[model samples]
Target: MKMIGLVAIVASLINVSIPFQSRAETVLSARDLFDACTRADMDWISFCNGFIQASNDHAVRLGMACTPAGTTRTHLVEIFEYSAARLLVSQSELGDAAGLEVASAIIGAAFPCN
Candidate 1:
């Protein structure tokens, strides 16, 4: 499916769509993000990019709560991608909250403020 907007969908899925909405992005449900990210309708490149963007946004936001010092944004995105991959493997059937939790955990574990 059209996965270009998966980020906004994900944000809404976790009840945090203010940033996207403020940017004029449409808020979609978790089902939509899941479909767009998992379905084959979208090309691999687009899907990969979407995931990268999604992971980037998630990591940056989570980093705000912690001191991710000495960690570059690029590195954070990469770790987030790995976390996303792990989520896809095991949490695919779970709800959107599950995904968000895992993402936060990944960032927190990798770059804890304490």
Candidate 2:
């Protein structure tokens, strides 16, 4: 019985430590930022870099989503936005430009205006 209890406790701890997948993946590093923008196009490199350096401030002003654990919401939002953009970009040949445009629009749209 003691061993079973110990196993259960350990499992619970692991579950708690693992951030929920539903919460979205946070963008933290330059690569992550770049990847998000690049999904739209190679032309977005400069755009992505500029935004990455300015992202924190943007997140603050725009009220981006953040984890209760203190993970910046911008990171997760960026990831989600990037994913949507990439999907559209990848399908541009398939008449996905509108979808990509909408997804890409959301990236900066979430930022709060000061």
- Judged by lDDT, which candidate is best? 1
- lDDT tens readout by residue for model 1, 14-91: 564234335333443333444445545547437644554565456567562363457554465466565555544554
Regions of candidate 1 where Cα sits further than 4 Å from its true position? 1-25, 28-65, 94-102
Expressed as tens digits, the lDDT of each residue in 10-113 for candidate 2 is 23333444343443344232234435555656556556545643544444444542223453544534653554444335433312122222322333343323
Candidate 2 versus truth, CA RMSD in Å, comes to 15.5
Clashes of each: 0, 6
For each candidate, give its TM-score against the true structure. Answer: 0.40, 0.26
Which window of 10 residues has the lowest lDDT sum in candidate 2? 94-103
Candidate lDDT (C-alpha), each: 0.47, 0.39
Assess the local accuracy of residue 46 in candidate 1 as a C-alpha lDDT between 0 and 100.
Answer: 71
Q: State residue 62's C-alpha deviation in candidate 1, in Å.
A: 7.5
